[model samples]
Target: MSFTTRPEITGTFGVATSTHWIASAVGMRILEQGGNAFDAAAAMGFVLHVVEPHLNGPLGDMPLLMRKAGDAAPTVICGQGPAPAGATIAHYKAEGLTLVPGSGLLASVVPGAFGAWMLLLRDHGSLPLRAILEPAIHYARHGHPVLPRVAHTIAGLAEFFETEWPTSFATWLPGGKAPAPGSLFANPDLADTWERVLAEAEVAPDRAGQMEAARLAFYEGFIADAIDTYLRDACVMDAAGGRRKGVMTGQDLADWQATYEDPLSVDYHGWTVWKCGAWTQGPTLLQSLRTLSGIDLGAMDLNGAEFVHTVTEAMKLSFADREAYYGDPLHADLPVSTLLSAEYAEARRKLIGATASRAQRPGHIAGLERWAEAAVARAGRDLAAGPGVGAGEPTMAHLTERRGDTVHIDVIDRWGNSVSATPSGGWLQSSPVVPGLGMPLNSRAQMFWLEEGFPTSLAPGRRPRTTLSPSMAEGPDGRQLAFGTPGGDQQDQWQLILFLRLVHGRMNLQQGIDAPLFHTAHFQSSFYPRATKPGHLMAEPAFGEDVLRDLRDRGHEVEVAEPWTVGRLTAAQRDADGLLRAAATPRLMQAYAAGR
Candidate 1:
């Protein structure tokens, strides 16, 4: 066995893992109180919104993959909100943006996460909405220890908020200064927001009625009213280096609701991996697995140069396809069947050469090549001069930026139910906070394209092709797992590596998560500015000199990153013997796992 920073948590009763220790503990607390996995996850989800405000918030997007006890298949709860009716390509262009700004009002989307959590609590969870929200309410009203990174992020943005967004200034700089790290930071407004929702919910006689009432409170009542009223009059500086008013209206908020959908899956080796459909970047991992299925990865050294090269090359090809084909399937004719076929993988696999390729080589789908070619051309020209500045999604950074990505949670209950969710979008830096709500609307609209030709083009009521991807899989040996990470485009790349290590290398959860990680930046970023770096591959320095040298020899633009800074992944698993296992990456020192 290899040295791991922590033991793989094993329990027969329940397990919950999340990017924040407080959220993980909340979930376990719920489970200890006999709440099922869905109930525990809902509780933990709310806690994450309060405790990890820099990483995620109530206004962000979340896609959940869940399985009921004894069910063979997992279903997706799509919390990703759609573009508002006023969010058209023409309006953005009229606002002088060729791309959506990374921050401010114009980039805001209908807040979906609040309603989504309510949905989970309503349909799948057993606890009352009040019970599910208690931990978050307490944390928000009283206080929680502020993460140092959160403090740093706030400090960096203090000037921006004070100068351009006074509402944000009041919320973040309570005393005209950023909250000190380790200080008890409270958002009494956020707590009041939840309390109001709970108050509205209590008027209902039962759990189902209460859940619906809470949803209404967020989407139709005071929350929506405050967001709409605030946005209508407010215009602030955006990524285009200009100030702009938002296009979303109260009608948009009232019109949107979280929906459940069938999950997309692909069989690899002996296990079946599942992800949210094309609407999210989840399918990118599935496509990478398909491409890798044709390769004999077992024969390669798990941490050696060849393995890294092959995996990175495969991901490049898959993400290239992602740029070309994947989108909101509701709006686009995504040839998912052809894309996932073995023959197509074989054809795409040939593009993986001995050296790294600089081109964004999207495959030629016979009937869809015109669309594919157009997307490829646009991708090539779409490269941002550099990363988007200011508040944006939980983004991947080397050591330069203090910006973090998203938050992830995986929960498995004693009853055998499981859920994996990636929640992101609303960050303190992303947009100005709604005055009364103490949370900013998500900037997920930045994921949409301003140009009119692609499936991801900004359209009324269409979901942005989100990068918030969660994962679930069933191993051949009857081990079921839920895992995900928080790098914008790197979510799947990190997940694929961990899964391969778990299934093929026979590594336990911690071992797999702790393994050195790497990802390519050859494709356009999903966030605003949409930067791309041809042949770029970032690896943890712990991967050592030989692996780095081999990758460099293969023509990769290799950059060594600080150790334990690449992937923030967390996972929970249940084995055939009914034993539960959980692990979280030690990379960020923020993630934690708790169980028996």
Candidate 2:
């Protein structure tokens, strides 16, 4: 029998799993109350915003992957907001900045998570908006147990919040100090904010009208006004080491809207994997799968040196392509079809050699590689030379220090509605608190480049090439899986490891997630102060000493980490036999999965 942290949760009704136990319970409760996966997901999303404020907030961005009942394909609900009209490369350079700051006003985009969640709730969910908003409101008002890590994060930034961002200090530090862990910490302001939106929504005639009212309140009414009012006059310190006022106006929020689009997919063996378009790092996972499909991974020992080497090498090649090509498709010509094509995967597979390569080698894209080369040159000037390059923003620093990443949720309902969503960006440290809202803006602007001509170059109204990727795949046996994890560049890398185990090794959901994890940092980071480590690979010590030595012999710079220190993955699925299963990672002790 395969070892697993917890037995796979099987039920006939529905299942919900998330990085946090409370959020998962909230979702499961919704499902038990006859809500669909979309309804449960919406409630769970709001609950996450409340209970895991250090990891996510209402103003964050989310990209959802959902396959509704009877739909043949999955769709992407893109909540990733775009750059403001005044967010010009010239303006940033004029501000004495080389790269976008990882935090503060200048790093903000029009808030998109609220809109996206509402969109999901309005279209696919069965419950009224009140049901979705209540759980979060209760937690925010009545209080929830504060995670020790969240308290520590607040303590670490206490001085900065107090001296630099008084609004943050006032909101996070209730008594001029961080709240104790296990204490019931309440944010009455956030509760009031939600209540006000709900009140405005209730004035409308019906459910659809009520949702429309809430949308107007968020995007065009008071919420937008509050954000606009503060950003216009507040000049604050950012990750770039300078105090600057953001260029985003209320008009930017008014003009922006969340949208839905077809998910990009590729077939690997008999499995069909789905991901968001190039605008996200989602497609990178597909590209890696395509490359690995050409190799007979099933023949290799699952935990052997050969398996690790092959997967790592394949990931490196695909990430190199991400650096060279992936961007917002609306702004540039992203040859996504060509990139994920079998022909491209075949040619790229040849570059994987017995010995690990040290250079960042992007495959030749006829018209784009020259610009890609220039981008490499621009990025080559040691991003580490700058103060903020390589160092993530304040919230990102909290993530590394506390091992806190983004939040993910996977829900599968009896009716066959399945959703996988990764919601991130807004955290207490990502920006100053928005006064009465008791939340911060997202710093997603850091993903953009100041350099023009590159696919990911900064531009007005273009979505940032976000690293927040969620995944869904269908097996040959008609088993549908919705799974994802929360690691910046490591998201797809870890997910790939789990996937290979499931397909080639025939492991179940819990077995695959419970298996030891490894990832490479050989590509450029998506965060500010972007940096890359050539041929760098980190794996859990559970891989054994002999395997580690063999990897070293293969020319990989391997770093053995403590067991259970990497990859906080969660998953939910429904098999052809009508069995619903869910699993959550035990690594962080925070994640949980629940079902009937």
Best by TM-score: 1
Question: Could you give candidate 2's per-residue lDDT for residues 1-596 as a string of tens digits?
Answer: 86778888999899999989999999988988889999999899999988888778898889999889778788999999999999999999999988888887888887788888888877888888898899999999999998877887788788888988899899889989788987898888899999999999999988877888899999999999999999889998888787899999889989988899999999988999999999998888898998999899999999999999999999998888888889999999888898899999999899889988777877787877676686566546677433321224222211464223589999999998999999987888888899899888888898898988877899999999988889999999999999998888888888889989999999888989888788888778788778777888898888999999999998999888777878888999899988999999998688999997
What is the total number of backbone clashes in candidate 2?
A: 2
Q: For model 1, what is the error of residue 517's alpha carbon versus the real structure, in angstroms, after optimal superposition?
A: 0.6
- Candidate 1's residue-wise lDDT over 1-596, tens digit each? 77998999999999999999999999999999888999998899889888888888898889989899899999899999999999988888887778888877878788788778888888888888888989999999999999888888888878777888888889888889888989999998899998989999999999989999998888888888998898788888876678789988888989988988999899998899999999898888888898888889999998889999999999988888888788898888888988888899999888889999898888898777776787677767845522334554533545323353689999999989999999988888788889899898888888888878788888998899889899999998898999998888989999999999987899999999888888888788787677788999999888899889999999999988887788888999999899999999887688999998
Question: For model 1, which pairs clash?
Answer: 394-405
Alpha-carbon local distance difference test for all models: 0.86, 0.86
Task: State the displacement of the C-alpha of residue 491, model 2, in Å, after optimal TM-score superposition.
Answer: 0.8
Q: Go through the candidates in order and give the clash count of each.
A: 1, 2
